[model samples]
Target: MVAGRRSGGRRADRGWTDDAARAGFLGVRATILPALLALGAAPVPADLLIRGAMVVTGSAAPFTGDVAVRGERIVAVGPRLSMRATRTVDAEGLVLAPGFIDPHTHVEDQLLGTDARARLLERFLMQGVTTAFIGNDGGGEADVRAVLASAAARPVGINYASYTGFGTIRRAVLGDADRAPTPAELAAMKALAARAMCDGALGLSSGLYYAPQRFAKTAEVAAVAAEAGRRGGFYDTHLRDESSYSIGLDSAVEEALAIGRASGAAVHIAHIKALGADVEGRAPNVIARIEAARAKGQRVTADQYPWDASGTSLVVALVPGWAQADGRAAMLARLSEARVKAEMQANLRRRGGAEKLLVTSGPIDVKGRTLAQIAAARRLDPVEAAIAVITREDPAVASFNQSERDIRAFMARPWVMTGSDASTGHPRAFGSFARKYAVYVRERRVLDLAGFVTRSSTLAADTFGLKDRGRIAPGAFADLVLFDPRSYAARATYAEPERTAAGVRMVLVNGRVAVEESRLTGVAAGRALRRMPREGTCPA
Candidate 1:
């Protein structure tokens, strides 16, 4: 028998293959899709009813209740609502909360083309994410309007937002140069940032650690960030340095705080960590600096992926940005030079020893081995081996530099939220949120269920200005995640990064069930969530 019961007036004919039925076997998603969930209308009849789940309202303890969704908003949420509904999900053993919102993600690979791959953002759904902000680390499209438009043309399974990347804008204005931007160049970058914010960007994002963005100084970043702030958008950044290799972790934290202070924009530090062996136990210092900044009235927050290993290219993890300033050919030439190669190798060793770098994907033969092991097998030193791999395939690496103590310290902070930084070649793409639930909330108890839910959902929504999201309340967007609390755990690992989590019972995006019974319903229910400039809040 079908697990769910159907009772609503808009019931369709048999077969769960159609959009309405496919979205949920319970039979309410079809009517809810176009007719309901708009800005003002509430729909004539209720569309979905979820009963018996422990609802976390983001403001208090979990309560047993019934949640009634109409159109795309939760019209009613209370204990035992005596109302009629089309479909009822018997969520007796489940936990229902606002759908998880990932504020930092690299989902551009899943949005590029009209392929089925582009539309199926199932990995995020399984982890209970209904909305994700992509275009992180300045690797997202420079043409902000075009990227958002393209995603809308071909819908995905989750709501999406993007930030205008300072690196992309800088590269567009001034090729890969190692100098200060002229007044005109700075104006162009600021114009690009301002237009993107006005055109629906949540903020300006920068990876000052990466190439062209690295070339830009702190003052230049402030100028561009200020333009985004003028439109009331935030500044999200991967700081200039996270280790002793350059500016050091403490200064990097200060730099992020300085950006917020100087620009009058809320600053969100992406993937905050004290990276490298040199900064192994300095999370407390970093936390202190952030607290100091916050006390001074700067709106500063940060997001972290729950992992010790961080994913990036070998060139990014090790090679000096100067050698790679012009292009790949310049980098390759730099690698060929003995003096330059030696300097980079010394820096690579200083960054982290070879044993800490695990090859995630690249050449098949070296795919799962650490640089130390691969170097031993290749009959060369670790630095030479890494250079050779980059020369050949430019494989990605999981650089394990962060301390567990630091991770816990950051997680314990109220200002810290969740982000996967989900990318190709990293397990975080599939397992970040789930991993937090399984390990941090359940195993370690560093974060309780209520705190975990709040951190993962509402905090992210509030920080990004996603109106009415991250809460299980009436008039809020019906983006939700339902899962068996006992079984919610991430199965993805570095060795098996493609695996999805377990215990996600159902996921809804704007009142349509995107995932049910651990399966993708093939429902492209997500809508582009734009930061409505005049309103300063996105409409679903």
Candidate 2:
């Protein structure tokens, strides 16, 4: 009998279905029951059964089916299961797909913070993300084991993994100076990378666009990355330049490919994009470079967010890397100089002018205003106005620079996957996955439904070595998302960055319900997933 409630608020079992049930069981039981018998196994009752949903298995086409879950694994997946179930969900008219895995996120503060609501990570759960990777852009903690331990001590709502951050390692070993590490310092950094990998980090993650890391030469990065690579980990990086900030977009892509070759690791570029007016239409060129690398048998993949505006701090957006050496105090000291101010003004113009930069977070009055507006009100040049704001606090801004042409070109590639680059004061933090489904898949038709599911879940899982977590199959982890295709959409905007997405009907993490009926279930079923250390890498 049909059970529970349907999407349109109708009783699930309203229509009696003796004939329909018989038809559903005919071919399914004939095929499945004998195979179980041949294997000397019998069908057992399921802990939870979701019946009659359109299941979009990441590896296959969508089909109407039932998915059965035992304790923490999907025990059965097929058209019609006759086994008794402890509980059943009538998923009629809903789309059940593998929960999306976000490759980039900055929810560390919320995950590790003192606030109970924040710790639940309801924002991500609401976006239909069952698993997320943290410690991105070279900002992860150096002590990987400690971070995992601390996170596990509390109840979290979603599964997570992390990469050992190169920036953190550099800062730990060599402070924030724009210089190559000494031989001893380099060795020390390598040791730290090795330790982190052994302690369960996914790999070495670097933000070459930021300080200390930006100072390191290509060879230096390869040297540190080798430690993780030797232990069977891949290298994930935020390239040094997405536009013409330093090495140019094409050159940065080449550098990432080179690092992979030198270090013997696969390379995954984070938030791959052509930013700024200088390189707005360079997505095709970037794609060609990565494709060429792949043809040559090198492992290369990338992730892209759906938004045109990229989120970052004003300092990173405007200040020259050389001027940002040492720390905040030194950087502020240099910002006051005429030469540095001129350079900052030039950088601001290159990034599409003050009008394109919208301040998302900072002091009370400055939150939603554009840099141009702030400058006019303060009666100062845009550069000086930015300096004034930075002097008090380095606020985050949504820099509108990318073009729709570039965004669509990159997203259409099979190698490119979805990522939020999620951070505070950015709509992507709460709505990236939902927006991709709504705007790109549903509206723009950039990707079909199956394609979106594969990129968002399967590609990331396979690339990062996350086994049994991104597909719908027997013996896989029961991490799934059920949503109304008609209603799923992103609600968060630049002005209302904290608003969560809509239409995530249910979310399951490791066989536990984390969200039901688009609301958090107050179930923190998340676990800190650790990659098994390569044999002999860790001390016995």
Q: Which candidate is the best by TM-score?
A: 2
What is the per-residue lDDT of model 2 for residues 1-540, given as tens digits with 9 covering 90 to 100?
A: 111111111111111111012233333533454357336576667789999898988867888888888777676777776667899999989999988999998988877677768888988999889888899999988898877776656767777788899999999998998888899999999999999988888789999999978999999999999987777777999999988889999999999999999998789999999999999899999999999999999989899999999999999999999899999999999988888998898789779999999999999878899999999999999999999999999999999999999999999999899999999899998999999999999999999999999899988877776766678876666899999999999999998998999998999988899898889989988877777666766677
- Among residues 3 or more apart in sequence or in different chains, the pairs in candidate 1 whose N, CA or C atoms overlap within 3 Å are 7-86, 8-86, 36-71, 37-71, 37-72
Question: What TM-score does candidate 1 reach?
Answer: 0.90
Lowest lDDT sum, 10 consecutive residues, model 2, at 11-20
Please identify model 2 stretches exceeding 4 Å from their true place. 1-42
Model 2: C-alpha RMSD to truth? 8.3
Against the hidden reference, what TM-scores do the models get? Answer: 0.90, 0.92
- Once model 1 is optimally superposed onto the true structure by TM-score, how far is the C-alpha of residue 506 displaced, in angstroms? 0.4
lDDT of all predictions: 0.80, 0.85
Any idea what lDDT model 1 has? Answer: 0.80
